[model samples]
Target chain A: MAKVSKEELLHIANLADLNIKEDEIDNYLKNLQDILNFANIVNNANTDGLGETIGENDQCNVFRKDEVKEFKDNELLLANAKEQERNMFKIPKVIQ
Target chain B: MDITNLTVHELQEKLAKQELTSEEIVQAYVNRINAKEKDVKAFVTTLCDEALKEAKEIDEKRKNGEKLSSLAGIPIGIKDNMCTKGVKTTCSSRMLENFVAPYNATVVEKLNEENLIDLGKLNMDEFAMGASTEYSYFKKTCNPWNLKTVPGGSSGGSAAAVAANLVPWALGSDTGGSIRQPSSFCGVVGLKPTYGLVSRYGLVAFASSLDQIGPITKDVRDSAMLLNIIAGHDERDTTSYNMQKKDYTKTLNGNVKGLKIGIPKEYFGEGINEEVKAKLEEAIETYKKLGAEVEEFSLDIAQYALATYYIIACAEASSNLGRFDGIRYGYRTENYTNLKELYKNSRSEGFGPEVKRRIILGTYVLSSGYYDAYYKKAQQVRTLVKKEFDKAFEKYDVLLTPTSPTVAFEMGTRSENPLEMYLADICTVSVNIAGLPGISIPCGVNGDNMPIGMQLIGNKFEEEKILNAAYTFEQEYKFREKYQPEFKG
Candidate 1:
């Protein structure tokens, strides 16, 4: 069975952009390990000559006319934003 | 008139005859919701006022002798994941709890065009993740059969509402077994259409490739009726197929003679409850009595289906969920020092434990060093599973199996162990993996008198065959009245 340690769990949480609380780490680790072990069953599958399936169908490169239809609900669109200024989403300082 | 007990078609007939007004129908459902919502806990929001307003307008249109769609004036609920313009489309998560949609999902739009009254948004597992609705950030939806038992999820609310007759029908999305399994537990008809048959636009994505919105209703005919209205091409959803238009209800002739039904032995193995097995066997015997050929076959790829489904579903979810950064929409955290911390903290605070677990597992499998061992291997197995289904379909018209291993379990029974919870999806996930259409209808009652469901899976775009077969079985079984949820609470 696959096992996830504290360090590994922390690293994964970081990669996934999730801030795990200090107390929840052990629980997360144990659950992650259990899920990974369950997922490890795929390794036993006979996929010697099988190709990976990324989607259900093969019709790709679907192009549409780049028509710019104006959406009239700008205020409604901005209603859910955490912080908005000058019709744009306001964010924390990015440049150091 | 017991408006709540009537099916969609019956309601339509009454409306046409002026036997019942849309206002009366909507008011009846509102009363039903008021009475049942506390125990069933099915809806996140009830649009009683809006539905009444629209129902009144639909009645006006009809009185003016204006031609309208057959579905006009019927009340229905939408699963919370589907966006309804100007309504909060929370996927039963804190992240999107207060986020109102700017546009309606295609299915919702289609229903709106038909003038079907939107009763409200139904609850579901957070981001449609867990097998039980207990993972919902809001209230947990209990099975209407017994309030102590869980409504199988993540479309638990949808199934429970229909079973309890809160609405004639509702919409649900299936990524894994979200729709069908819940319908099985709640004893309603749930249909997951062929993946691209219905547009996924405005559906909050969990796994883009696997997700498809479908119907949960009281009977096979209602499912077919709803599918007829929703199953069409939409340009916005590029993945939506542009097939020749099909009126699904036209094919429900209830004739399954000479139909080849394959029973997958893997689905009926050790973990399945003996009673559930007996119920399915009884259903198969009924099918045989209808002159349909029944045979058992080994769908060996079933062993790897669950693993493949998790890997792909989680990987896609990890990528898809990255959109909820707390900047544009969804929940935002106050405790953050910088931009990176903002992203991390908002997600951590907004999401529930099960959602976090899936995101973590999803990220882990797709991360470096483990990608080939887990994600890629799982994808390969997915292809193999699909190929195996294709091979099976060549010989059989449809595959019949139990919708779930058991009936509705007690609320807290499987919540503690996530793996135990996932096993509930074992019978239905392979249909999604293969992108085929499958329907669940009640076959009989278990020892506890809880409903047991049998699944009928068809090849891609072969829903008509399954519907014909399901309709045939449904007519004979007539379990709808016998096993109907009586609201135990």
Candidate 2:
């Protein structure tokens, strides 16, 4: 098995858009190592020429007919929103 | 009947006959919850006033001689992962503690149409990761059997609620053993219907492909009644099957005579507690007496199921949980100088220990360099696991196994060790990986006197067959009459 170095953990966390604290890097590395050890067991199984099982059973199109439908209560729809700005959901600005 | 101990069938009968009012039933359960929920910590949010209001409407409808749905006037507990409109839908994580759902889950919506009473949103593991439900950011839910033991989780609160008789039945999401293990621990019937049998449009995503909403009830028939209402195709859920709905009660009358039940040998050996194994063997003998045949089968791929499930479930969770940033109506920390720090600080402080652990593990497995070796390999092994079941089901009508290897351990037993808790799901992960329907029915009590569940696995979209087998066994075993806990409150 290839070694998962400290630099690799940071790189993966970046890809996942997760910001891990500097001190918790060691703990994450150790946890990652244990998980890898467990995943290694699956490596021993023979899965040659097998298709991946992505979703459960099968995925079929469940669509509705295009037509006008009665709308739900707008007030009820907006009741759970923390910030309702002009009938729209508002969120903190995302950094570029 | 004590409101907690009465099954949905009995409750509905009383309401239909005007012997009891829906409002009266709702008040009874709410009053019962008032006396007990403080020590149990099973509810994250209780719809006390809302439930009473809906119950009054249901009773008024009945008085007007209007048709009522099967679940009408029944009180059902919901897992925190399932969205209840206008109610807090925290997945027992600090990240979404203040988050309330704008819309209801399809199951919840259907139950609402029937004017069923909503008791509350039950507790769960943070982001539905851990097995003991101890990883929840909120206070852990204590098992009703013994306050010290854990109610096996992700859906621990749902199972604990039903078992403790807090409600007649509950809706829970099972990704792997979440519903079944806790049901086994709490001594109730928990079913994980064939993937896509029930809609997942509004269930908070843990692992989209692995999750299915099903009922945890006091008996097999109650499970059937709940499934009859919730099982159907929904246009909003792409994975839901476009299959015709059936009256599940019809299948219970079908005899299990000449039915072949496959007993996978992989589940019986190693790690399985001796008491659980003995009870399983005894149940098999009982099946033979009832004219059913039990035979041995092999699922070599099952040994790798847990490994595959964690990789795939975590990979999906890593992606699904991306929607919970400080923005989008969850927790927000304004103490940060920049937008990036705001997102980071909020999630870092908001999520619990278990959710963070899974995110890190999932991110690593699905990372570019290791994706093929870990995630891809697990997916391939998953096919092998499903192939094993398909090969077995060709001859056998259903498969049986121990729902959980050991009985419920003490509350603080595996809290510190995450891997040990993960292993408790070894028997259950294969069913989820295969995407087949499964049910965990209480077979008997172990030497320790805690309930033990025997599982049944059926072919895809064959929830009725699984329910038939459980109902048949329930009638013969009389497991419903064996309530061990004190539910007086």
Candidate 3:
């Protein structure tokens, strides 16, 4: 069984960019540990001489014409934005 | 005939004969929804006015003697995961509670092109994550057969709505058995098309590789009808197959004589309820009577499927859901001092516990140190599972299994334990992992009278074979007559 420590849990949360509250970490730790332990069964399976399957279908490298099509409606695109300026999404400032 | 009770084909027949106008049909369904919404709780948004207006237009076209498609004017429900332009496609999460789609999903557009009346957005697990609707941020959908039991999810509402006769048919997306399990629990027919058989453009992503939109309906033929309309290529979805268009309805010839069927012992093993297993056995016997060759087979890699599914699905989910960072769409935190806090607090506050847990688990598997051990290894195992199915398909036209290990349990029965909750998907996830077409048809009922579903899995692009096999069984057995929900409305 894979044991997940508190520090590792917090580090994972950080990597996923999720904010875990201090008290909630323990619950997350226990649940994640349980899931990981269950998921560890894959390690025992013999995967030798097997290829990875990233997708199910055989079709690949499908390309469309390089012509640009107009969406023509920026208002609709920006409709769900929390804040917008001049039809563009407004976000917290970066690059101090 | 009651407008709400008519199948897609029956309703289309009536519409063509002008026995009932589209407005009248839409009103009847709305009335049913209004009466049963309190009990079934199947919809997140009901488009009553919009549907009525569209129904009137169809009626106008019918009066002019304009040619109409088979699905024209039939009311159907859309699972909340599929985007409908200007309608709230919440995926049953607080994160997208107020978010309205700017565009229609490809399937929604196809439905619109057929002039099908849209009833509403059906309830589902938040981002199609859980086996039961209990994980939904909205109200849990109750099984129409018995209110005490849960409707299987994350397409719970899709199956429940059809079972309650709220809609004759509804769309559902299956990733790890969301469509089939829920349909099994709710006593309806659900079909998950082979991955890329149906376009996934504009579907709210939850484990993209596994997710394929399908139909949940009262019977197998209605599933075939809906599949005919939605199964096609779209350049918008890069993964969408470029195969020639198929009329899935043509496959329902109801001939399964000499069809090869493999019964996977792993699916019928221990954890399955005795009654459910008996029902499946009886179904197998019925298949033999229909002249289909049935043989017991072993899928050795079956035990490893759940672990592989969770790792791959959650890992993909973590990457896909990263788009919900309070920037472009969905919920944004009210108070955040910086961009980092904006991403973190919004996701933490917006998403429910199950969604967060999956995200965390997904992140862990895909993280630097564990990537090769968990995520990559799961993919390799996925290849093995697919290969096993491929080998089985060489001898069999379709693989048969119980859709769920047990019939629908009481609400909150497995919610406390995440592992127990995932076990409900034991029989259905491997199909998604292998990206094969599978269907769940109600075979019989358990002791508690809840429905038990038997699954028919086919090779890739072999939906026709499974559909015909299910059609044959449905014709001979008449499972629908055994248990009918008494709709008080």
Candidate 4:
């Protein structure tokens, strides 16, 4: 089993897009190490020929008719938006 | 009369015969919520005025000689994770704390079609992540059995609400024993239906493949009734199975004679509390007395289930929760200077620590250089886990186990140790892993006076068998009536 160093924990947190604070990194590393260790138990299970289960059922490529429909509740949809302008979500500047 | 104590079936009979009005039933539950909610902290929001208005509308329809479903005028609560259009579905997280849903969850829509009065949104572990409501960004829901102890979660508020009689029933989603564990802790009935039995269109995703919504009720019959209304396929949810419709209530004939029951011996091993194990043994004896054939069997994959469950569920969660990136609805951080910082800051400020931990772990396992070792290995073991259930089901009709290793522990005891908290879900996580239907019914109470729940697991879509077996045991044991919680407000 590999120990999750503080650097690794921060790297993982960065990939997950979570801002791990300087003070909170140690706590997270400790907890993450414990959890990863627990999760390592699966490495011992003998599953050589088994295929992975993506879901419970056998359905694949489930599609619906590509027809346009009108939704009359644009305001309701945008009601929770942090900022809205002309029925579109207003976000911070993207693309420098 | 204490109308709040009556089950949904009894209340339905009264409503049908004009002995009670839907408005009166709504008022009764609202009054109970008003009196007891402060202590229990079950609801994130209560729709008292709205519920009364809907109840009155139902009464008017009934007086006009219009036919209605049996669930019409019945009061129910929804877990905060399920969308209810025009109502805030917060998932007890600050991330979506003020986000009003644009559409109703499919289950909520089905309940609306039945004209069932939705009392409000019940609290849960934030993003349905934790084993206790202590992790909720909103208020922590306490066990009705004891104020200091936790109501097992992430469906804590749903179970606590029903156990406290705040509502006759409530909807709860289970990924890893979220429904059944809390139901066990609070001495209520919680069912995690077969994964595809119910549609997940409007439910806020935690783990798409494993998450399923079911009922939390005061008794087994109410569970069946709620399942009947909510279980069906929808085109919106591709995973929803096209099952032949059956009235779940019709199977509650209380006859389990010659039923084949298996007790997974591994579930009763070390770490199971003595009182809880004793109660399970007593429940097995009850099934035997009812002429059900009970025997012990080995489900060896049980030990690895928790590990596999955490890996898969978190991996799915990390990807699913990626949608809350501050561009759309949900919380936004004012501390960011650019888009990338915006994403990180908003999530860090929004989600709780446990949610962050899972997200980080998920990202790590699914990240490059680790996917094959961690994530893929867990999936392969998942196949092995499902095969074990399939092998067990070939010989036995249903499997019995303790819903949790221990009764509700005092709050703050396990929350500090995240691993210890995760261990609480050991007995319940495997059911979600295998995509099977599992129900937790009150077996008896422990010496601490906290409730002990016995889990009855069925093969995929074989809910009726477990329901029949549970009904027979419910009729004979009558555990709820004998050990009612006294919440003196």
Per-candidate DockQ values are 0.88, 0.54, 0.85, 0.85
**Alpha-carbon interface RMSD for all candidates, in angstroms:** 0.9, 2.3, 0.9, 0.8
Question: What is the per-residue lDDT of model 3 for residues B78-149, given as tens digits with 9 covering 90 to 100?
Answer: 999999988898999999999988889999999998989899999998999998888888789988888878
lDDT tens digits, residues B1-489, model 2?
576678888887776677888888888888878888876788888888888888888878878988877568778899998888788888998888877777888998888877777889999988888888898888888888777888899899999888877888999889988989999988899999988889998899999989988999999999998898899988788888888898888879747899899888989999999999998899999889998988997777656999999899988888888776676567777667666676677777778767877877888888777889989899889889888888998999999999999888998888877778889999999999988889999889887678888999999888888899998888988886865654322
DockQ, candidate 4, comes to 0.85
Error of model 1, residue B266, in angstroms:
1.4
Could you tell me the TM-score of candidate 3? 0.98
Model 4 alpha-carbon miss at residue B3, Å: 0.6
Give the C-alpha miss distance for residue B375 in model 1, angstroms: 0.7
lDDT at residue A60 of model 2 (Cα atoms): 50
RMSD of 1: 1.0
* TM-score of candidate 4 versus the correct structure, residues matched by position: 0.99
lDDT comparison, 1 vs 2, better candidate: 1
TM-score for every candidate vs. truth? 0.99, 0.95, 0.98, 0.99
Q: Worst ten-residue run, lDDT, model 2 chain B?
A: B480-489
Candidate 1 regions with alpha-carbon error over 4 angstroms: none
Cα misplacement distance, residue B357 of candidate 1 (Å): 0.5
Real A-B contacts recovered, model 1: 0.92
The clash numbers for all candidates, in the given order, read 0, 0, 0, 0
How close is each model in CA RMSD to the real structure?
1.0, 2.4, 1.4, 1.1
